[model samples]
Target chain A: MKPAMLYKLVILIGILITGVADAAAHTIIVHPSLKVKNISQALQQAHNGDTILVKQGRYAVANLGIDKSVTLLGEGYPVLDGQMKGDVLIVNVNHVIIKGFHICNTNKGSLRNYAGIRCESVKNIIIENNRFNNTLFPVYLPKTSHSVVRNNVINGSSHENTTAMESGSGIYLWYASDILVDGNSVSGQRDGIYFEFSNGCTVSNNRCKNNYRYGLHFMFSDSNTYIKNIFSDNGAGVAVMYSGHIIMLQNRFEYNWGPAAYGLLLKEINDSRISDNIFGHNTTGIYMESCSRNQFSGNNFNMNGWALNILSDCTGNRFDHNNFTGNTFDVSTNGSPEQNSFDANYWDKYAGYDLNKDGIGDIPYYPVSLYSKIVENIPYAITLFRSFVVSLLDKAERAIPSLIPVSVIDHHPLMQQYRKS
Target chain B: MLKIAKYTVYDIARNKIILSYAIFLLVISLSLFMLDNDPSRSLSSLMSVMLIVIPLVGIIFSTIFIYNNSEFIELLVAQPVKRSYILLADYLGVAGSLSLAYLIGMALPVTIYAPGTTGLYLIVTGIALTFIFTSIAFFCAVISRDKARGIGMALLLWFFFSVVYDGLLMGFLFLFNDYPLEKPVLFFTMFNPIDLARITVMMKMDIAALMGYTGAVYRDFFGTSIGMVFTLILLAIWAVIPLIIAVQIFRKKDL
Candidate 1:
């Protein structure tokens, strides 16, 4: 036979085998008020590639261990109460899907192992459309890969008497990779979504609000894409620490106000891309500390206390094609000889003209004033920020561009405002 | 006084609402223990939930308990029993019952799942909150003539203890972020019940590294036996001061 005919024969055989396997797949229905005494038993009876339908009922089962490649679907909020026995559900199998269940009441253990649903060392898992209500550690993925967690609602209404020192994340991913968390709602937890030592993940289209701590917190996680998410009313917004190759795009960060709160906090991070994001009503729009080689473009920084707070040790970062309007301060820098560049941005404070009609201002706009640098070293100097002496000094510094770094000025700033709506 | 205390305990113990609350807590605590993959993670989750829920339940349950028993209190006051004894009995009875319920609801689950100093710390915190909120509820009852006002006062007290007190402390820290006010702030934070709870749990967990400079300062001063004793004393004061004030007000207030 010819080579093409041999390839066609191989494909035909593969299709037939897969067709037979698909026919063998089973469907198990767990109806509301089903009198199944043991959830584990229901899971045990399910076959590989089976679908277990759990329909609206309260299942007070603790530790429903799932070790099979099966789909568990819940209809109308089937409640799984752990009763503090251990993790509510432990998924230890590949290609397992858990969807649409209200999980609550995770037990407080000493070793920090309690979770509403724990995926340990699993692959190709899908956890979607679930509700973790009043749970301690709601959804924990440790040492897992290629998982998707989507459209889930995780709420942690922690009380003083019941709380333990180690217990509070809504969704925690540690040492995991290639995961996608999308379209979820998390609130009132210590950290809404925590990523530690995880890499190559995507977090998009999620709403995290009113969390006790950070809405999205990552430490030592790299090559992650966070896009189109809404983070609001949290203690702090998205915090990227000690990571690299991060892409933050089109995300809405607002109302994360406190002493050290910020819309996006970059600490010891490098080589990231942050573009097309909306940051408003936060204590600080973007705070960079010890970060380098990052690019920020097409972002809207509005109504924030400080549009950008660049601490010492940040270098080679570029801010261009962004809109900075209605902010208390356009930029606050700590160190002199700023290594970063701010060009082509639309600043509301800019008074420069486009005399040539080239859409670029004739004169450069200095973002970091001498007064801002003084306030960085001595914050109390902020008290005299609007004083005549400080104003004269700022004017002198702008005219000469001596005290502040020359590169920090937006040389080709846009004459017209860029409205991001 | 002892008879009244016994009667209050019996009434709380027999109430279906308290029973359901205890049962609900049991279910939740047990589920939490079962759900967590590691024991330490579960402990932290429990601690977080306890921080918010315990104070809410303590204040609400005590306030409602006091208000609901107003008729019974009037009946007892009509007898020869002194109001002071009656008030003390009511406070003790309410505190004891709530603490007992918490023990059954939360403490047993922590012990079974967490099983360490952290669990013991959680139990102590639960008991402390029960006593503190019970005292605060009695104070509210003594100060306010109307039930709605009394309940509102209890809720405000809860709000102050839970959220506003922390906000004020944070504001002070931000205002004085440049200063080295760690030692004085440590003493100041001890006055707030929520801060005390936070400090106690942080001390037990040995996870002070997460709290930044504040934890470092706390570990520096409060890592010793002297610090522990001071914290315990402050916690004791937190429970006692409100009770003493409530007793004083109850002695003077007309029924």
Candidate 2:
């Protein structure tokens, strides 16, 4: 045969083989009362591309492993209970889809990070529309890439005796990249969603509340985009550490109140965009340490203990067009910030006049009050909050322009609050 | 006692100082509410006004009123009425008139602009401070024979509570910075009606979160209904103890 005919023949044979395999793929139904009573037996009878439909019943499975590229679908939300022994399901191979199952009780008091669904070194996996209850680690992805975990409700057995920090995270991604985590409601875990060394991930629209530790935590995760997430009442709120080029937008961080609580804590972060987020009623809105070159714009810092507790180590960060209202102290710092810029922000405490009616104040607004510095040095001195002497001292400091840091002044303060026009 | 209190109240109500004080408070409250768009900001500004202006007016006005009406008080003391009744009548008249002024001037505007638990608490604390200072002023007036000396002492009392106490507190906190001062500071705040009122009203505002751990302790104590009632009762006690002691001193004194 000629070379052209040989190439066409190879193409035709490849198509025919895939067509036969596609035609041979069929569904295997497994019910509790049926002859094929367990998932392991059903998996033995299933092929690489076959679908296993699990009916509504309790399946006491321990360390169930799925090594094939198959689809595991639940018809009426089957219960896969690990009986607190080990991992419920470990997906080892790629191209797997596990959907609509209630996964629970995966080895809680163990040293190993057992999960309801553990995916190791897998690609193109989809874990969606599932409920995880009383799980150690609800969905643990290690070295997995290009996966989607969406619309899952994960809740730990948040007992009063066990601290949340001792429990596992709802959805944990370690060394995973290019994953999309969306629309999941997570609570009662050490962290609602945890990303460690995971790069190029997209996390959006997740409600993370009442966790013992941070609602969302990112460590060494770079180039990640998390938007429109609500994190409330967590122990320390969200923390992003040692990350760069991350885009955080439109997130709400509220009611994370305590001595050391912060709405968003950034440490050693650089070149990130944090915009349009609301930090309200937190002990501190955004606590930044050794952060540089981050852009914080159009964010609302309202009713927090300290709106932005930017340490002296943080520099080259710019804050513009943000609203600072009802916070006790707009900005507090231990030392003088070097090169941070604040412009066009609306502060409710700005007492400057706008004679030109250009919607900008005529004088530079000094946000760091002397009282805040005193409170920062002596935290207990906050007991004198709203005292006549405190206010009097603040007024005197403002008139003299002394004591507080002069570098953290907003030259063009907005007379009116920033509105998204 | 009621007849005497009624007459004193009427006399104080007709006085020009009380009328001007009421109008002054009304104008300030109205301007504060109208000038700022945010009711919370206005309420906070009004809080500072309440903290400083209320006590100043309460103590000074009451002391001066007592000194000005010394002849009438002496005449009443000489009559068949008891000395305690005379003193209590003066307390009731001054406290009642000052509280009414506060209610009309500050509370009415606050209710119209920012009606909430914080506003209501501010009103209650304002009246409490008024009664507290008025009673203390009666004590000052009863103890001192000269009018100028009594007024000076009243001013000093106001200055000490409003400004100097916090100054000393800040110094103590800075000095003992190594130790945890949350509970100790709370104890100190209890001694001053001004600080107690400030914390009580501050906790209800959104900025209570700014107090951090110290704020949490205050909220745990002052934010609860039972704690609030306890603090109000304490403020009531603050109003009564000084007056009782003054009454005791007045009853045994020679003319």
Candidate 3:
């Protein structure tokens, strides 16, 4: 061959060799009856872009690290028993997918924060259709972005006696941004789906119930949207603390009854839009403290202890076009309300008449009650609930505007409730 | 005793006031149920009405009936019957009629409309309040000779429990705001049948969630079967103690 042709031939051969190698990334089946009995052996045998098909058998593997970009797919949901050891699978590379595996019995202790699947500093990671039982941390991602953790069932404690402090979160995302956590049913964990310093995430269609702590908690996570989620019977429901620009829509919060429990607890949250949500049968439906500039409308507060416990610190929040019905106290504030406007809301306890044939009542409806004020000051006074004296006091207070913060009135109180379309 | 009780029930059944009270209760509950499609909401309105009206009517009517039945008692004392038997018969008659009125009025409507645990709780508390107030009214009647004084004292007792007692409790709670007053407040509630009845029924309502830690304390005490039994026994004691004292007074009186 000529010299230039020899050089072109060498380049062509290199391209062909790389193309053949890329095409050779095939599937490696690992079974109990095979030579490669465990996942770690399969990981060692497989190359990047390869698929490790795990067969239906119990693989007792712990701290199995995947450093290559590969797919670990289980056939018939093979059990990967952590055997009360460390993490079952720790992915250190990007483009890793772990699916259809029963990951169970990770280290229950909180020292190592052992998870069924822990991904660190990776992207395009998909952990889906997996059942994690009794794992301390079901799916933990740290410094990972653009990941999808979907359709995962995580039960922290197989036995009912485990306290939330003893277990870890169902899906813990730390410093991870733009993560999509969807269709997860998380129960018996600490905080079901927790986001700390994770921004611009979307958590939707998740049922986080019966968790010992907040069902879905996001601290210092900004611009996240949580929609169509059901958070019920959790210790403190869902807590959004120190976050801004959060949008929570069409969420159902129910049956979270405790001294400190609330359907949605917002502290230091600003510029949030919480609309079209249903808060029913919670201790406090929405407890906002030090939260400002938030808009809450089209929400139904039903049968809650305090529909909106907006403390004196919350300012500039507008609540309009909402329905407050069957709640004990429509609103309870410690001191005077600070520029929090409430208008066009239907209150069940609004005894004002709409005399002008308009739907709005002529007299402004004050959501705060004297009895609620008394209860706020003296919680023990709640024992006198339904007492003739208390009812009489409430009636007298209503007749004459006294004790309760008059500034927290709904100017255009609706005669009929706002129906959901 | 049964014969005397039967005659008293028959006589009270014929009275216009008792009939009208029953009719009024029926009208209020029926209207409340009709006004709201949600049974729980109607039950809440009905609960407040029942709480206020049941005790007021129970105490006032029982006290006035005892005053009006003084001559009947005098005639009974002339016979071979025991004074305790007459007083017991009067109690049975008054409590039975009032309970029947409540059952027919509130309970019937509640069952028809808001048939649930809350309605059952309301009925139980209403009946318990009826018995308790009647016993208290009987005690008030037997203690005072003047009719005005007897009725006045009964009204005062009602006012104390229904209005003044809670005011005092609110004052105490405010005064001791820094202290943990859940136990003390719960202790104070046991002294008033109205408060007891209110709490018993309040447990069944969604408003109980507002009570927070105090509610948990109450639920711990009142949610269990033991606590329920304890409340029942205490309410029974409240009914019996006043009647026992009234029977002693009636036995010693020179009618």
Local accuracy of candidate 3 as per-residue lDDT tens digits, B91-124: 9999999999889888999999988888988998
Tens-place lDDT digits, model 1, residues B126-155: 788778778878888778888899889888
Model 1 TM: 0.59
Put down candidate 3 lDDT per residue, A260-282, tens digits, no spaces. Answer: 89899999999999999999998
Instruction: Summing lDDT over every window of 10 consecutive residues in candidate 3 chain B, give the lowest-scoring window.
Output: B206-215
Most DockQ-accurate candidate: 2
Interface RMSD of 2: 2.0
Interface RMSD of each: 14.8, 2.0, 1.9
State fnat for each of the candidate structures. 0.00, 0.62, 0.69
Per-residue lDDT of model 2, residues A141-161, tens digit only: 999999999999998884566
**Which 10-residue window in model 1 chain B sums to the lowest lDDT?**
B206-215
Tell me each candidate's TM-score.
0.59, 0.95, 0.95
